[model samples]
Target: MPNKKNFFLTCAVLAVTLTAGCSSGADAETSEAGVDSVAESVGDAKGGSSKSPADSDTGRPRIRLDTTQFEEIRMYQGYLRCLKDHGVPISVKGNKMPEADPGTLWFPNIDVAEERPEVEKACLGKKPLHPPELDPQKNPDYMDDYSKWIACDNRRGLKVDPLPDGGGWNYKPGVTQPRNADQIDKECMIEAFGGE
Candidate 1:
């Protein structure tokens, strides 16, 4: 039979050995995991051209993922304006640049707008949301022919619709006729010119 001191000493040594082994194993695993994650992060950081650090003089890769949604600036401004006109508070929708489609622009997770019936009405016949003047597909004030439309803008032809079918007839601040395209009492502008 072992003495009491010897037995206690053996137990202590065993415990220390087990703990040291487990910690060393854990540290090795952690180091391997960290290296793997760093490599993955650098790989994902590659930009459109997929250049490496040594490939260019920059010694760093730029990442610009084209994965973003769409946003209609004019329509959102109108929405906010309409809310202010009606004495209601307005909030921002998505902060990211919305993705582009054939016609629709998607902005997900708009806050404080869920309870607004006016905003809901504003978004009718379209996804996400947009003010009326912006939706050429639905605005009664603007006729549709895809031709007679003129994009009057202080910021170039960023917007397009029939010229005389102009509902937002008067814009404030910086404003002027379109430098890109012009139109008159034409197809969609029929109603805009007092219905043909």
Candidate 2:
């Protein structure tokens, strides 16, 4: 989930950016299956040594998997975030950059087969239990008609940025406007995202 502003922007943007909706299927059972498959491969590759050099000091090995490239690929980020949020100890290896994919996540404490369901239910559910503000689709306060509404911001003496077609508005970085920015932002959102 994203913050309020980001959430609204994403809602507007996603209509353009994503051609298909996503499916969230990771659960304890699926996680266990994935872990077993990886474990077998790793076991064979390193004589069943699950410990990597980084985690060897702890004597508790971790299961790592190469995941997708885009952090905007919310499915993986949401899954990992859900795992951590629910107190499942996880370690992400490699540099995390939005543009870079194939990062790894390691589960240190989970007995992949036994705890997979708990993780799925707690952190891998259909919605992944994001904070309320992060999900604009569920937020009662979110606005929608950004195209016509942005004009209101421009008229209010706010230095507003343009919205891309089928996308949301973003302020040009480092730009300044009125001192009452907080209120102005709310007004802008209301105007931009409100019904036509």
Candidate 3:
């Protein structure tokens, strides 16, 4: 079986890659809930290190947290550090990374918010990382069901885009919908599709 952290890192990397250069309006509350859940699952209650390094761009030290279980985050952090070293503007969600833990981390698309052509060019030179295989089959019935699910969300006052023509599902793109679209209660989907 795949390591669970690797699995999530793969999924998150894929999501981030697909949505690269797109501005994010992530739902702060929803994201906090996820972090809290992860913290609980990992038995960690401590917040990340306090006091960003004095040289940090915001004149505030960068937050650091231990992410021992998710090793891939270290590389992402290295990437961010590289960008910062090269004068690229970046921001981490909630301004934190797990203390001492490295291997995976999350950040908004700096490319979308910053205009550092040199830094962007440098980032492009690095090899791109791909997520593990997660192909979801898209048969007609699934598409039809997804359509209904989207409709249900719309009816419930959740803003969701229509699934593309083939109507396949992937991590959603763009910030036009709710920040928590990925975690919208599946009970609504169940109510809409009802086992199809």
Candidate 4:
């Protein structure tokens, strides 16, 4: 029997090369697509590292996520790192993201977002890092908490409001000069990052 690992590798390589070969004409096949095209459509979540998904510019395609390759990528540190390396933006259904890649926050269109000097500068060309393993997204309480935080961050012009200078539990705004992490509430970072 063929080695399973080698089999998958061969499949991926053939897919990439064939894709490149077919598109050399610069005309994307407009017909209905298969799994390869589906990867192209998902915006190539290959953002954690340098390698981009094939045909990233092609219109977005819906991903089944049930595929073996996707399952591997979802669990692969290197793949998530590639997403960050390439500056591909990631956006999750909620803030829930891969625990293995902490620094890799979810934002849409990572490729474009990476072009922004800020992210490029922030990443410092270093290997992508996943955020700390957060509370389980599957938990009902965490889901509720996630929604609350999302809503709170959605509140326009959310300023950092820490204790002693503002409301106890309720954050007060208009506190000129938002200070560092030590001076702000824990929620400030989440808010500043747009609740990502």
Q: Number of the top candidate by TM-score?
A: 2
Greater TM-score among 2 and 4 belongs to 2
Compare candidates 2 and 3 on lDDT and give the better one. Answer: 2
TM-score per candidate: 0.17, 0.31, 0.30, 0.20
- TM-score of candidate 1 relative to the true fold: 0.17
Question: In model 2, what lDDT does residue 176 have?
Answer: 67
Q: Write the per-residue lDDT of candidate 4 for residues 134-154, one digit (tens) a residue.
A: 123323343344344434433
Off by over 4 Å in 1: 1-71, 91-113, 122-196
Cα lDDT tens digits, model 1, 136-172, are 5555554442233233122343243222433322223
TM-score of model 3 vs. true structure: 0.30
**Under the 3 Å rule for N, CA and C atoms, how many clashes does model 1 have?**
7
Going through the candidates in order, what is the number of backbone clashes in each?
7, 5, 18, 27
lDDT of model number 4: 0.29
Query: 1-196 in candidate 3: lDDT tens per residue?
Result: 1211122224334323322111112222222111100111223368544432221222111111111112333334544555655765555534243453343345545442256665644443221232111112423365555567667666655554553652223333453655554334243444434453
What is the Å distance of residue 106 in model 3 from its true position? 5.5
Clashing pairs in 2: 28-116, 28-117, 69-101, 143-193, 144-193
lDDT of each: 0.27, 0.38, 0.36, 0.29
Q: How are the candidates ranked when ordered by TM-score, highest leading?
A: 2, 3, 4, 1
Q: Tens-digit lDDT track for model 2 on 1-196?
A: 2222333223212211221111111222223211111122236654565633222112111111111112223334445555676677776644433233445453334443366666554442322222232234554543334544456656765555654542335554575666654345445544444332
What lDDT, from 0 to 1, does candidate 1 have? Answer: 0.27
TM-score of 4: 0.20
Model 2 whole-model lDDT (C-alpha atoms): 0.38
Candidate 2 to truth, TM: 0.31
Worst window of 10 by summed lDDT in candidate 3: 31-40
